[model samples]
Target: MQSHNQARANAARRRQAETGESYAAALAAIRQDRLNEADHATEAGNPPVDRGPDYFHDKPVPEVLTELVRYHSHRIAKHLYFAMDEGRWRSDFAEWQAMTLYKLTDAAAHLNLLIGTITAYLRDEGVGRYFLRRYLQVNQDHQVEAYLTPRVEEHLAGLTGQPAPEHSIIWHSVGSDIASQSGWNHPEQHEALEAALHALYGNYPDDDEAFNHLPPALRERVLALIPLMKDQEHSGAAD
Candidate 1:
């Protein structure tokens, strides 16, 4: 910014000498030229960038950074509570699918995009250097993140969750995760079983409730698995 101011002042002096204008008038003219340039750049879809200070310009950088971290922490905690709470829970495949259930929401995609954009931006800006050498990853507790749990594999293995052991808690399993979990042995069968679990289970704690929830014809279709599996894991067929 200092270099830019110096360059602008030099231009104003030259303009004043050439146009026989007062120093103040010359400076005003130079400023107007820059405004016009910025307008043109915006029209061209190449908006100009001269990052010096943001709107909270009076605050020191450390103070600004501190406030950002504090408030964003509150924002993130609220987000997690809202997402993970029983009544508002979400994941990869809320919509029905042949594969058990991938997720109940698209939040993972949103979080990944956030991580990609912010990390790239911080590194591009010189500020990212502060932690680069000292930290193994930027996606540490310092930033938002997304990941999968073993439960996803559980779901894929045709392990329907058991009824809530208590009102607030549900123990999820079908058979031994190792026994039921298998490689893609029978593609068509696996696909059938995977889909059937989510569709049949359908948030019902009991198998009968899930079966009753669906029309008889479609009820069994939900369990179709690709990399196939079944809890108690038998459909009178070979794996």
Candidate 2:
């Protein structure tokens, strides 16, 4: 009986690993597409709104990064807890696939347009270097970042001719693998997530200098987000 039980446990573990892998692959693909869309949107001249630093002008950079890390950590923890619950918490595989697929689609659409505009402005103002630097600094702390941070950093670092340490790369890759196994539903958690992201974007190196580097349309988008970022700051504080 003991041997039989051990075999069953092993089988269950295998299944969980497989499920997590499938989920992670799907998520990574979705994020990639979203990033691409942002670039495409900017190139097409259909720029989205950019909320200026009012979004996060008053906030500190390290605080923003910390918030982002906490938000994701909380999200991942909740999802993992639910996914591992074999009782009332057990979710159907179909549900997991469907939900993540839709989330990816939406996230990609939003990012494509936003990132496109943001990058265009960065290119114009010659602030891509600032962005690259800030991103690198925040991502070097792999102990806390999500799976996406290092991956994005790796690609961005390559663009800047900076080599990412092998250990950091491995750590993020493993984190991503672990994240793929989670599947918790919590839109309520987005408040904190958005706040952190807004803070990071708001605290760009130099507002005037960076703005000058961006294209007109891209500038408009950045300008638009400033308010939103500020709102998020207020919201985060209130919470």
Candidate 3:
């Protein structure tokens, strides 16, 4: 009976091996496909910067969120750039532009998942739930700034409403926390940024400074999201 069971198990194993996909192989294939697509996009004038696992991690809430937005924005940009570069986009006129804008907006909305992750971490910290909720509102402001900042000035202006005391202080601390950290490494950083900018603007910025220095259109996008940054500030000040 034991021999029969062993034979049956061996047969099952052989069958599984013949039909099943290896998880590692599948992952490797996916990565290879992505890399190929990225290379093709770059050749077509869109650079690809794959955001690796290391780029996202445990860090101060504000800082991590801010970086995530930056990183996420670049990914969206690269994705779009490749889409257009590969001739996947059908049109480039104003109507098409509007559609592209919507895509970018959608990308921004999708990034809220990352935002939620950071918010949860902050909540776990000494930060209060109320403050985290408000902080989320402020983080939205930052996203508005970094994403739409380059596209709309008036929008950004309106986005930066009078930040409450908590929002102001906490947001900066977060930014400071991220800025102080030893990140921004990895090769894809600049390439992703450039691709994102080139897709939105006619030209890409030379560096993060150049990108941030972009006229109110892009700068205001990030600027628009600042009020939420102040939520923690107000909460702390309230104490």
TM-score, per-candidate, Cα-based: 0.23, 0.21, 0.28
The per-residue C-alpha lDDT of model 3 at residue 90 equals 67
lDDT of 3 by residue, 156-208 (tens): 12122222333243333333333443243233474446444444433122122
Tell me the tens digit of each residue's lDDT in model 1 across 1-239: 23454576778789989999987677778879998986675567632243222222344444322222232233343444455553344344443241222232344433443233233333434433334322325445344222222332232222222332223221123212212343312334434444554554343222223344444545556534312444435664545
CA-lDDT, candidates in order: 0.40, 0.43, 0.44
Total clashing residue pairs per candidate?
29, 24, 33
Maximum-lDDT candidate: 3
lDDT of 1: 0.40
Candidate achieving higher lDDT, 1 or 3: 3
RMSD for all candidates, in order, please: 25.3, 24.0, 24.6
Q: What is the lDDT of residue 236 in candidate 1?
A: 44
Which window of ten consecutive residues has the lowest lDDT sum in model 1? 169-178
True-vs-predicted CA distance for residue 11, candidate 1, Å = 0.9
Worst 10 residues of 2 by lDDT: 176-185
For residue 155, give model 1's deviation from the true position in Å: 42
Could you give me the TM-score of model 3 versus the true structure?
0.28
